[model samples]
Target: MRNLLPLRSALAPTTTVAAFAATAAVTAGFVTAFAAPVAVTAAPAVKLVAADAETNVAAVATDGTTIRYEGLSVRIPAAGEGVQAAAQSTSGDLSITVSRSADGSVVVKTDKHEHSVAQAASASTSRANSAKTCTDSAYQLAGWKLPSFTWYYNPAGTPAALSGTASSAITTATNALSTACGQRALGLATTNGGQTTAVPQVGTTGNCIGNDGRNVIGWVAGNGKWLGMTCTYYKTVNGNKTVTGTDTALNTQYKFFTSTANCSGAYDLQSVVLHERGHSLGLNHVDQTAHASAVMTPALSACSVGKRTLGLGDFQGLVAMYGTK
Candidate 1:
């Protein structure tokens, strides 16, 4: 069973801060499906401190908890969740979910079935045992949905040496979600708010929770094990959870390729953005072992451009949440 817990700002001494909303990041872990293999490493242990009373910083406990900074609230997974845990936190009507990926193996794709990177190692063995199918239709909701929101981009955070059309690629990736689910279902504005110098309120060391009352996407430079993280802020309205704000940060330590034709060992930018956008739009990671074809799966491969497109389960999940077109 999944757990939904409300977190209090460690900075608040007496009163619970309700004005700020929650944040989440969809950290990426990569694997390769081609020939040369990428080394898989474990994510570093998160260290937390109060810093100062005004910092709103808090530590993640053994059972997962909330961390806050002023009006910014974030939820980090416990010790055992690793990168696989899909954590969701609720504070009154506001809630957040952080979806992360784990170190993956090669995802196998055959005529009969496709295996997620997380399950690729065992796929061959399973295939030998019995015929596998790619018909797994499974997805989970984040308990919230955005009726409509216009997001902005921060080109200042773009990698200094990135090639290809980064901005256009990101815009296309963001729109891919609504395209998959149909506009009537997810109603995201076709136009963005343009680029801005303002950065996402997420940090490199701890939880990705921060609420600045804007939907922004940018990059963060760090050695964190995850590829990208999406922080979505939502509040309950009339008994329904509605998204109010969001911020997404892509780790600069890893190399990303916008054009698959130029892709070497780098991960696909559109694929990563597609996955994060799914989280931003209120979709959680389905069991990758069960739904490998899903864009909502927690694992991805280096050149899996196919992920740029949503699977049957991904479409169904969105329709289920926002309603059918």
Candidate 2:
């Protein structure tokens, strides 16, 4: 049953961008590999707190481990042999307490101000449902087939110039996608359908597909809510979901930084492209905020360069779609 999955985004918007039939499934996220356990004596009560005006609030343990969520960072101290005192912030309604679980995992509890507890509970449930919806939608291309793709610096009918940074970024993204799935399904080509389609002009739409069967990659201004998008056109031929073509467009409207040092207020180009390429390879967004560390996570955090590499869930999704070597 090969069907077109709806266009998914890196971030959820107030309104839907495109509509399509829904599918049902559950997916998991990256799990940290714990090393051998070590016994230690009870340490002193520790507390640390920090906040960001724009994106997140965070709290740090005495050892410097941190956890942040919902634009707020609550404070948690290093867990001794047992539970410790709760920490609260003066400015916000956030409070956190730390305790050791039966299985030896550290547990942290958070609470809003007494008045907003009900509202906070409702909002938390809503976010959890949204994340579940995303986790359930780890999409894969039909028949487990991998398609060969080529990139165009210049395609017919448009005049977008490819900067050195952009070109390198695309190459890196393609290579990462290819290597991540352990498949040789993508490559670079000099021409498409015998036509020398020089990289089309920036902001040109609808130039990548039609006539040429090759998948095309380039940049465009993603209007409104999209940071990047991939249109993977596939059809059911002879009971197989065969891909016809794919076109990837990066949002030129957002600031893309080539260098990590300059990544403040912008996204990492390779990270964004790597995610878009996942779409081209028949993988859909893993919308769960808990899996935000996954490469296929629907939305990217500002200045986050972590998605350049595949997480456990991202790799598992690719393997499920394509197969392991």
Candidate 3:
């Protein structure tokens, strides 16, 4: 069933954050796709931390359950059920489905025919996967540095049914992402320093410079920001709000979930968003390898659950942008 989010804060805490309003950055001088320096780093690895049953974080992975998401309405009628997803990362094969009950309630699902952690290895093998090396300055962002999968929304992976356990799974996955992203934010703050005063953007919503104390999240976010953005899809709109600020989320009501079939925990929407938010904070993806896994790794896997919780590399990266504590 569809869970409507109540009008709330810039970032509201919900059982199903994806069912709640949720809300980033990109690579490039402005922000577009994920790119990396010509240099290289070692392979990538991850470490994990259990923040709570619902939340886990990886400093190297990004942040944590502080992440959030929203359920999207899909209209595809080909397979079993139409899926809900705003965007899909082209990183691999993905399908979406959703089924509506007579009650006008929505049940979503996805099927990632082919998407895996090993695939990430082959997909982004160069500086593209350079999130492994933080010491390399070539992997820096000017105003904002976009990552390889930093497209507005990459061709996402397979999706699962929205109803049944899918919703809970989706919600859990979202929370996990928030936790991971949150940790990375802290990592940035801790590495560079901690925030004490105002946000540095100078505007209600703007690009993130680095964690000064206050986050560079967004503002127009409320209720279900993602849901509200539905009116702008495929209309040359700005897509989802990509600004930076603290506690800001995407158009909750406006989310268009990617497929969910194999997505189960394979792909955490909230976690993915949380990772993106990290980039907005001026943190870039750490190359894979280095006997360390970064929150910025291009791909995420179940085995990476722990490492996804902010790690030292992630913290230091944030520090590099903001200041070291």
Candidate 4:
């Protein structure tokens, strides 16, 4: 059965903006190639931690109910669905959501919100003292990791503007995530699995598909509502919930630039992709109000390229989760 959830109800409204600019959505998000699927173990009635701050929120909930965490919210899933979580980007701020599945698995989603240059500048000015003191050194733990996984690119629906450089930009984005821990923890192919018909499982309206046992990343029509979205799926293995699949979708609604020098009013593809990739790797959104420079922060500014590199908190959080290689 298709695990369905309406986007409008799932992603709650911020004070100033709605969750997504598009319509409703369906289920969840990643890697490896040509390997036989591993059987997943299931346990019942798992409760997730709910916190008001961004750094301590659990990425998935196996309790079979909807949940809200500060800036994040997730809806319950249809029966027979595996776990999934999502990270979403908006015109206002970034946030994350998680859902429970019938089989005791979980899902997570995350996004990066977009902001005007003026607003970005003002935020920086106000946080200047904080940034200097390393107050930006906060990161969220999504409770899962992809120690080794293979991801593929599906450029079939890539936007015309990003077509020329999307592949290389994605490569750089994923690489940044891999090396943040001081070693090549991600076992992705130096070159991706090449283009395929498989698009990311994330829906245009911010829903996701169940784990299909493939990790695909690509573009889709999102109509400027979001910059990028990531969905992560988890399964019980030896009483521990481990990530089984993840997928990322880049919205074609907004214009994106590959080069900082050439960026004008457009977003930076690598920066946005890097943030989304952080979600895929089990990093939740830090509070942008407090950690504006961190890649895991919930919002981003137009023409910003700093996110292409991990900030101090981003690095520490990654090390805390995956440990330094």
Candidate 5:
């Protein structure tokens, strides 16, 4: 199911996410991995790529009916397909839909309505390679079903754009985020099975009210000092980290487009969303999931960064929570 929740932002200080899960995500953000090479997608098309050597790639895509994951390719629904494929991509796992505006008009802002999408991924081989397991012993409350996310946008920080590629980018980013905080893939990998789409609800417009956001989105003090806050049911990211996420309205330090910070300016929106969504999924940053460069890494390092795909550690965590895939 491809769903999206809008985000609101604020200029506060230090905070964080749930127990160990949040801790791992937060911590992993610090460790950092080699940045991934950016990939781009043109409008009205679907693209595929398998990492380094793994050929028999498992993929997840929005098939309209449901997000189906299968071998090689995920199932795509026959109707209303290709909505936001690149944006909702399940990190080499799945992608969502992005439709052309009525009259084929191009708007700068992201649209609010959403289209259904199928999730496809390499269930067997892809699981271990695509994701990282959640290992922060802190938020160990397993079996959390489709937890909802509260959206926020910074009040002081008005939307940079509401009707163009910027808005399209925002929608694509959030649609990709649907897979954030994914259910543990259980090594073998599995789908949500039924269309158990976790709907997005309105969040506090002015203030981020959850524990998750406070910590993920770091802030600073007026006297050249740094500050942070803890949050639950919140969204956080470093703009320098990815473009999908905005420059921290409160903290310029936390730029979502961190990958774009250097000469290698590519907006790997899928990867960025993958990391940010991880925070949303309640998984904290981690270095021990599989390898250190995983997207779950404490931070986004330079070239050859995070797995750019899910891995075994991530599946283990999902399997631990949900049953077999």
Candidate 6:
């Protein structure tokens, strides 16, 4: 089953504080002949503190050179200079500029724009409502640099008639994701990892859970409700965030259509594999009824073959996370 978990990516903060400058006012009264003219110098620069009491910082780099607070990540590009920060949200992307002052402090500023209360309310409502529904977008595996996957072939537990076709379907799904990412996202390889014990009888488990990071793909009997499952695990590697591995399992108990077209009552092998691959590639279910056409939709009705091809939104999400080749 496709998990409905929220896709939480580190975003740069949207709020900003402008540099404060004090204006000097000169009195209009005529100066006495003996009075010397007063020269006015610019106000002193505003000092930036290393931290603020009210700011909610999410994650900070160990070296203190990078700080992620309120969806914004501020990076000190160079010492004794300035910082660059960026943020992205459904509304749009925001960029923040940080300048060093003469007083050895930093000043942060953002582009001025009107934020309506209606927009904030709408966003809040959408978030609240989406807590239970599937997401409309995809998320990248956190801290992943050059992310890729390797799936081990396992046909021992699979149905004999469908084995070859199933393996081919896995390859097709891998290629689809790679094409969407505009880079190689998954590959085939050999490994000695044992079969996963994560499969739960359909009614026995409410949510899919288990070991990840081996990049293994195989078959197992499932309780009828789910056709396939994928679990991805994450870790930090040498200060870079990355997905350690993903395990994809198909239900051997269910009848699947191995042929390319027109299997009246059976599920499409490629369709299920494609959906599971999306999960392994850091995509959550787009379960909303409005997004039913998306390949990432949580539920797949039997005999539905349309999902074998990527939907527009699904493709956009892939491009959003991984740039074009």
Best-performing candidate as measured by lDDT? 4
Tens digits of per-residue lDDT for model 1, 208-252 = 645777878888874445577666665544556677676777778
Off by over 4 Å in 6: 1-146, 180-212, 236-241, 260-262
Candidate with maximal TM-score: 4
lDDT (C-alpha, whole model) for all candidates: 0.52, 0.40, 0.28, 0.58, 0.26, 0.44
Looking at candidate 3, the ten consecutive residues that score lowest on lDDT are 227-236
RMSD vs true structure, all candidates? 14.8, 23.0, 22.9, 12.1, 23.2, 19.9
User: Residues 274-322, candidate 6, lDDT per residue (tens digit)?
Assistant: 7766655555445335565566655455555556656555655565556
Native-to-model Cα distance after best TM-score fit, residue 144 in candidate 1, in Å: 0.4
| C-alpha TM-scores of all predictions | 0.60, 0.47, 0.29, 0.65, 0.30, 0.48
Q: Per-residue lDDT of 1-325 in model 2, one digit per residue for the tens?
A: 1222332222322211121112321111112333654443434332322211211123222322323322222223223321111111111222222333234334443333321111111101122233333233244222323444555543222223335466666667666754432343324222323223533221222112221445566555434334454544444345444455555556566666665555445656677777666655655444333444456545455555555655544555555655544
Residue 25 deviation, candidate 6, in Å?
79
Clash count for each candidate, listed in order shown? 7, 21, 128, 29, 121, 12
Q: Give the winner by lDDT: 2 or 4.
A: 4
Which runs of model 1 end up more than 4 angstroms from their true locations? 1-136, 181-190
**lDDT at position 37, candidate 6:** 46
Better of 2 and 3 by TM-score: 2
Cα lDDT of model 4 by residue, 1-325, tens digit? 1211122323322121112212222133111233454443332443342322322334332323443333233455443333444544545544555544455433444444455444221111122223422334567776666646678999887777677889998988887765542444534323466777877876665556456767788887864356786777665445445667788888787777885555566777887888877777767666555566677766666666656767666666666666654
CA displacement after TM-score superposition, residue 154 of candidate 6 (Å): 1.0
Give model 4's clash tally.
29
lDDT, candidate 5, at 278: 47
Clashes of 5: 121
